[model samples]
Target: MRTRHVHPRPADPTSTSRRTMFVVLLLCVALGSVLAPGLEPANAIGRTSPAATLPSQDDGSSITWSVRPSPTDADPERPNFGYDIAPGVTVTDSIRVRNYSEETLRLDLYASDAITTSTGALDLLPAGEEPTGVGAWISLDSSELAIAPLEFVDVDFTLTVPADAEPGDHTGGIVTSHRTPGVDDGGDTVILDRRLGNRVHVRVDGPLRPALQISDAEVSYTGSFNPVGTGSMHVTYTVTNTGNVRLGAEQTVTTNGRLFFPGRTVTPEPMGELLPGNSLTFDVDVGEVWPIGRTTATIELTPIPTRDGDVFDADTPVESASVTAPTMPWTLLASLAVLVGVAVLWRRHRRRRERREAALVDAAVREALADTPNASDGSDGSDGSEQDGSEHDEPQHENGDRDRAPDGTGAGVGGAHRSGERRGPPAPRGNEQ
Candidate 1:
């Protein structure tokens, strides 16, 4: 040591132990500052937590949380927050989030559009999907939030319907999610996210059309050979929602004769929910006694209101379609065939009877002609006077008989005598001269 005043070795300011102590104090202070506010008794928060519960990844314990519309909000049902707004208008709403867990929790908040699943159940879009409808129109005050143990927070959001927004029911949700730390599964770190939300039903006021159409109505009949027997009938049709609003349908399929007389009525299962531009094909099997011949199959569709607080009216518009199908009556066809065959047989019998009667008449005429006396025979004069009279009429009678008989001996005899007259009886040149 220098004999002159040796200042005590200044305490080493850069020592490793001192630096370590400083870092530890800093960490303790930071942790205390973060946890001190939440450590105060839960009752000091002055808000009631929701009854909803969520399961945690650590030890399978449960965490209770909920998102609901603020108490003063319109249509403040817990999970369904509905609003009726006009186009080119802006509306503000708040949702209350509650945490009942013993430890503080952080949540990621977002807005997403609602969708119907393939099974026709309502659901929300997955994270990272681009929002297009109601989700795009919403803006939140806070995108992230932290809640103390047994504490609740209310989040305010603004919804701005564009001037071109479609006039109908648009659905979306306000979602809050908690992402758990990554876990090693199959050499891959998988992070699980749990989410809860309140559904937002926004109805933009404008002209709303409610319409339904029944199309492609077809009826097929498979008939038995026996016309009186029952057969199978199938009716197929398509139901389309052509309007901008959702609708449910009560369908009635009927079969009627010319004057709409009741034949068969079949009421299938109600058409549940039909969204805009959606179509459904239905096939119904109806069994009844279908009258033989043409019948009309008519489909009548009455729309059932799907929205809440709707009044039923008797004059509701109904859509109808019809198709004509023919049922063949084999019995009538067979009877017609039988009648045709009887007529043919009766015609043949009548012709045979006429031919037999003509043959008998011809035979009787020929016998009467053979029994007549021949007035040209030279015989005794006992009946000379009568014979003379008969001979005198015989020539005239022979000419008449020849004209009547197409083939007879009288015509041949008359022809020979005419030839003799032409030769003047051979001029009597025989030895009789």
Candidate 2:
């Protein structure tokens, strides 16, 4: 079987500031010494003590230290301990613990099973916690050590895999701890146990099944108030390492709709190494997305080996999950509602005004028709216009009869002489007759 090892970076002494910190371990009647939340032991020995977190002595002296895999002739720059051992096999290794303080220090050394914190950082089980895996298989050369100031110790240990050890990866760490007396804010005394350790990965020869699962996939949309503007989509899901081997993943999030609206793809940050049974959640946002009523979000994960040279099928199928959500433009709908209401009101007002104008014209025409005299009622000659015409015609015919002579021939030039003779002498009338 081929073997592979992952190398980690060294601890930086100046990574943290120099502040006097303390971890107060509570003494329980049944639990003995129980560690607090922040004081939880870590597995990555690369965590160097910032003199600030270490307890100081009466003389203002503090102990600063670090631990890592012991350097060997074959691999002088070895950062952490890694091994590919078979079941029932025995392997021997060593760790180097260095004290950077001016005072001599006494420390306790032990091994613990590896655990990952809630934030995905690698940690180790507390010293008070029992180990059921590789941590129990290894035996340290010495559990206690007294090192001089600025000096280092190379502690050797042997690991014997159980005859029936399960095949796959088993992780743990070798930690160095030092306890000192400290005063709490209440003027009470407490013991501060400072720890530093390097991670150990032991992979037993066996069938490696690298798998991942995506669950609780969900999508939500935030729509814009602007009718023509686009909205944003939020996608959240959890990724779980369901296989025995440590694995990493590359994720691709895609969002699409029913319409030909172009789909959007988002590639979030790469995920860190995930140990078996460990899970991590991711939240991603896709902006500038038009609300097409309904949208589908799909997540695709491609598995990656944390350690190089670790062979698995290259054609492993990609794990995928999908969820759909409604993306309705409620703001736009409200705007449309307001516009429709105004249009309806305007239409009603226009109809009312038109009805009022038609009513006024009808009233004016009725008044004009009532005030005018009825020409159709002429049965009674009491009509003033016809009475006046009859009176004038009668006077004209009587005058014409009085002015004419007895004989129609006596009219004309003799008419004037006959009228003068009747008023004056008979002689003038004889010539007229």
Give the top-scoring candidate (TM-score). 2
Tens-digit per-residue lDDT, 1-433, candidate 1: 0011122333333322444445443443333343322231101000122354444433434455677777674454544677789998999877787776655768888888766544344556766676887889899998898877667788888999999989977877778876554323233334445567777778788877778998888989877666466565789888888876667888888877445334888898888766566677889877774555777778988898777875556776899999888866556567778899999999999999999999999999999999988866845444433321121112333223432223543342234333223211111122322
Mark the 10 consecutive residues where model 2 has the least summed lDDT. Answer: 22-31
How many backbone clashes can be found in candidate 2? 2
| Candidate 2 residue runs with Cα over 4 Å from true position | 1-55, 181-192, 379-433
Of candidate 1, the 10-residue stretch with the lowest lDDT total is 40-49
Candidate 1 Cα deviation (angstroms), residue 4? 69
Q: What is the lDDT of residue 109 in candidate 1?
A: 86
Candidate 1's error at 409, in angstroms?
Answer: 27
Residue by residue across 232-324, what tens digits does model 2's lDDT show?
999999999888888888889988855567878889877778888788888999987877888888999999888868766978768999999
